[model samples]
Target chain A: MISRLRTALIYVVLGLGALVMVAPFLWMFTTSFRPVAEAFTLPPRWLPGLDSSLESYRRLLASDVPIGRFFWNSTVLATTVTLGYVATTTIAGYAFARLRFPFKNALFALLLVSLMVPIQTTLVPLFLLMRWLGLVDSQWSIIVPGLTGAFAPGMSGVFGIFLMRQFFLTLPKELFEAARVDNAGHFRTFWSIAVPLAGPQIAALSVIIFTMTWNDYFMPLIFLNSVDQMVLPVGIMSIRDPVGNSSATSEVIAAVSLSILPVLLVFLVAQRWIIDSFVRAGVKG
Target chain B: MTSIANDAAAGWFSPQNRKETIAGLLFIAPALIGFAVFVAGPMAATVVLSLMKYDLFSNPSFVGLANFEAMLDDRRLWKVLGNTAFFAVFAVAGNVGLGVVLAVLLNRNMSKTVQYAYRAAYFFPSLVGLIFVAVIWQFLFQRDIGVINYYLGLVGIEPVRWLSSARNALWSVIILDIWKNVGFAMLIATAGLQSISKDYYDAARVDGSSSLRTFWQITLPLLSPTILFLLTMNTIGAFKVFESIVVLTNGGPGDASRSLVMYIYEQGFKSFNMGYASAISLLLLTITVIVTAIQFALSKRWAFYE
Candidate 1:
């Protein structure tokens, strides 16, 4: 009886915590479907009315704000960056793990050291470099720096390299030895053997990089200047100036709801791999 | 005879070694080039830029120590730094404390479905964009019509201006930050708890130890490393808080919530004080490095490995 009581208590606590975690998102969704006046009601209506207004979403879609363009820009940018990061990090990680090269450890150490340098320190110089290349206000400014993986500490090339290298290091050396004995070169061995076997890591890395790039606000805010070039996060903020002006409140809520859908969908589809990656990374550390 | 023949075939300059070396270099070239141009080069330029006074349009002239000197007398610099420190302390403590509690509660004796559901719900906010997070919380924090104030009014409390008041703005951002990030700490703490062998708990039970005693003596010691890891990471992240502030307050009614990174952005991009911004950036870099080093050093005293 006591054991059963304890179990029930645990469930109650867990349920309440989960509600707190989920309330903001639920509120955002309901408010997106609420009319402006209803949103501002005194008691704060929690339920959508029978009519279920779509005016906010309609205005968001019909406006001259180029919501569709912003979505397209973010999607394309994130996809390109994810693909590029996988290719670069995989090759580099494999080389570091499996092959002997001159000054390899030193170079790898340099990469690790660079990870500690905050992005703010490098922001000015990088911006100047972009301006010199005449890439400011263009998607290339975001994409080019992103290609390097040094744009942010968390999603940088160094982090990906470390993750991939750690994954590759655990593989049996016999596999590579056998491939070498069969007269396979390094590239051939990597593509034929390593690449085929890296399904889980690739999936995890892709999801991580995709979400990071998609949700990125700082880089795009700094680099992209025009409406056509702005990403979703920045574009959403642009639509609702200074946050809570009653006129755009519902519209901004609608936009926020829309902005999170892609990431939420991706999370639902890949929750296992995504959650597992965080756990594994934490345990490894 | 075979060994002799193999030795003869593999000379000082072997084809296999040469091929592997060339392939490795080619494979790592993109990463190396990227590091050089983007990270290393920029890092070097930041130091030089800090020493020169150059706006984007004009030639950068040497201005030795002026920017650094100006930083000392800059009154707003102290305010921003204080705000950043205040934010880092509360945010890190709340996230680490709450994360450990949640992980302990959900670590055992739950159905698989319930476990997954709780994990998903907790982690959902972290996956959303910071801008969206800021917007959602902004709506909920509106003094007149927000859900929070509405609830407070029911309980006979006055409506608090969450983002408008100077004193409340910083705390509001901190609360939003804690809400968004506690899940991450939970995930990390959960991983740590799961890794603790069941044998330890079994041993404690055999000794007839109470649950509280077992947690204090066994679970906490075992979980210290994870706690330390979360502490360091959360501190670094909190110090660099930008997106939430930008979207919600933008340094606010009187610069009450401007973070170091935001100030750097304002100075460099808005005021065109490139030299001053670079100096401030270096200061931020120094603080981050020193704080991280201190945490690692302190972890030695408490974090258990075996």
Candidate 2:
């Protein structure tokens, strides 16, 4: 009976911490549905009236803020980065794990060292290069930098490569060997055999890429300057300055809610596999 | 047999070897090119740019160490550096501490339903954007109508200026960061905890060791690698903190909560001082490298990698 009480107490304790953990989310979700002034009200309304429920969202969508355009930009940018990252990392990582090439280990070591350097060091130069190339204020500037490299702003290329390599290493060597013995080229074997078996790993990689790209603020904030070019994070910032007048809070909250929901859905549905993939990759922030 | 042995010895470009080399290079070419342009090329350019004053609007002019020398007289730079360090040390400690504690609690024999629920709640913030995190918290930290102040009222404490007061501003940033990141740290710790075999705990139980004693002696040593990993990543993340500060404080009530990266952005973009920004970023890079190197070196004594 004492043990049962202890378990009950532990549950209460754990549940309290979880409440703190999810408080902002709860607040955001609740606030997103109400009028701006309702947020500052004393007891904090948890349930909105049916009329106020979609008021903030409608205000944001219909406002001159161009939020819908931002969402489209984010979607296109994220999808392209995901596809580019998946294609590049899968092939490169596969070669690192399964093929014997000159200076292969050295190249992988170089990738590891590349991860250690922070992006701040490269920011000025990348900006300069983009300006020199006349790509500044273009979406391509944001996309190109994130599309490749070990420390892309959209996602970590080194992590993706390492994940794919680790996954590839687990597949039987004979699968590739069998194809090779039949006079198949590496690409042919990789396409016809290896890629088919790596569905879960690819999905994990794509999920990570998509989410990271969707939330990427730094690259877009720096590389793209136009209102039309704005991605969600930066676009929303333009819409709602932190110390804006009292009337802006609910709309900002609504914008934030819409921005996060897609990634939240992905997280909620795939929490298990996502966490496992992160742990397996020994993820870095 | 002799001919075959000679062929093996002489063939540096055997058909299979050539095929392997060609295919491997072809496969990895995009990654290699990307590394060159984005990472290696920029790194090299950062060094050169630090020695030249080339604002985006101006023609390039060579400056001989003037930017680095200017660092000696820069008051704001020093202040922001100190601010970043304070933020890094506390935020990393708070994150890793909360993460480990939560990980340990969840690792206890518990119902699966409760376990999954708590895990998702903690991890949900990590999925949200940092900018959104600041937006959400900005409401909660509002002095008059804010739920935080409302709760503090019940506890008999006065409402504190969370993001506006210089003394309290950095702490607010740290708190916001720790809240968003604790879940991530917890997830990593949970992963580390799960990997630990059940046999060690069984042995500890049979030995009649107290739970605290078992935790210190067995669990801690075994978990050192994960802790070390958390320390390195969290420290680096804290050093690179940007969007949250941009949204929430904008370096704040004064220059109280400005970070190294924020300063770099201000100099490079705001003031158009590319040369000085490059110099400061090099400082940022050096400090991060030294700190992580120290962490790994220290881990040599305690980390129990399997």
Candidate 3:
């Protein structure tokens, strides 16, 4: 009876923590759907009525913010970067995992050490490089860096390689040995043997990279000043400040909510894999 | 590093090593190029740029250690650094503390479905951009209209200034960070908990030791490595934070919530003090590296590996 009571108390605590975590999203959606007046009330309504209107959504669509342009730019930039990581990280990771290389340990150490450098160190020179290349306002600037781990080469890319190396180290050696016995070249061996079996880890890598690239605001904010190239987060910034102005509360909330809808949907579906991947990564180290 | 030794022992290096080296080089070529261009090249230039004064107008003249000396007198630098440092320590503490609690809670006997539901709830917010969180939180943190204040009013407590006030601003950012990140730390902790052998629990039960005693003695020591990982990652992640606070407060009430990164952005881009900004960023980098080294050295005293 005492153990059962303890279990119930644990559930209650977990439930309350969950409530705190979900509150912002709940407030965002419910407040967005409410009428402009109630949305701005001194003490919020907390729950919107069934009479909640689609008025804020309509306003966001009708606004002069060029929402579609931002959406396209974000989609293209994120998609390109995600694909780039999938290819670059997969090969590089596989090489580090399976292939013999000169100065391999030393090289990997350099990558790991670079991870400690803060992103601020790179921003100044990255901007200078972009200006020199005449790609200051171009999407290419974001995409190129995005492919290089989106923040620091020391971070995302190196992380992917580390994960892959750990994973590959676990596989039966006889499998790769068989490929070598077939007189297979390194590329062929990787393509035929390693790539085919690494579907799950690669998928996890893809999903994580895509989510990261999509959610990135800082790099895009720095590189692309043109509205036509602005991504969702920065575009949302330009649309409304969402603070201090009670009048625009509903519309601003609606826009921000809409901005996250695609990623939210993606997360809902991919969350199991995401959770499992984190668990797996943590378990290893 | 152990993995490399393992690979070498596994005969990844053999009579055919020369051929493998060429293939390996070709495979890693793109990553090498990326490193050279993005991190290595920029790092080199950043160091050089830190020593020169160029405002995107004329040739950069070498200014010796003027930029580094300038940081000593820069009041805003000291303020933002303080805020970032405070956030780093406390934000990591909040996340790790809550994470350990949640991990322990979830470890209690429960239906898998319920456990999953609880996890999804905690983790859902982290999926979207911090931009979205900031926007939603802007209203939720509103002084008068916010639900937080409304709830406080119901308890007969006054509505607190969460973002607007200098005193509360950095704390509010820290709160936002803990909320956003505790899910990740919880996930890592859960993994760590699961990896702890069930034999430990069984033996403790056999010895008639209470659950609390077992947790303190076995669980925490076993969790030290994971906790160390969280501390290091969260500290680094905290220093990198920019957009969420930028959207929420823009370092308002006079640099009360500005991070080192935000300060760097303002100096380099807005104020056009690129050289000084570069020097400050190196300082930020130095502080982070030192803190991480200290964490690692400290971990040697208590971290359990088995």
Which residue ranges in model 3 land beyond 4 Å of their true spot? A42-48, A148-155, A242-247, B1-18
* Residue B262 in model 1: lDDT: 96
CAPRI class assigned to model 3: medium
**lDDT for each residue of candidate 2 in A1-285, tens digit (9 for 90 to 100):** 986897789889888888888777877787777666655567775555564667788878778889989999999988888888888899998999888777889999888776678777789998888888899988888677556634546355787788888889999876876787687877998888989898888987888788888888888888889999999988888888555465576788888999989988888888877777766655322
Query: lDDT score, residue B48, model 2?
Result: 88
True lDDT of residue B276, candidate 2: 89
- DockQ metric, candidate 3: 0.62
lDDT of 3 by residue, A147-206 (tens): 765342224567777777777777787888777777788889888888888889888777
- State the displacement of the C-alpha of residue A201, model 2, in Å, after optimal TM-score superposition: 1.5
Give stretches of model 1 more than 4 Å off.
A1-3, A47-49, A152-154, A243-247, B1-14
Interface RMSD of each: 2.4, 2.5, 2.9
lDDT of 2 by residue, B102-170 (tens): 888788866777778888888778877888788888778878767788889999999988878998888
Q: If ranked by DockQ, best first, what sequence of candidates would result? A: 1, 2, 3
Q: Which candidate is the best by DockQ?
A: 1
What digit string (tens of lDDT, one per residue) describes model 3 on residues B199-302? 98999999999888998998999989989988888888888879878987999888888989999999999988888888887887787798789778978886
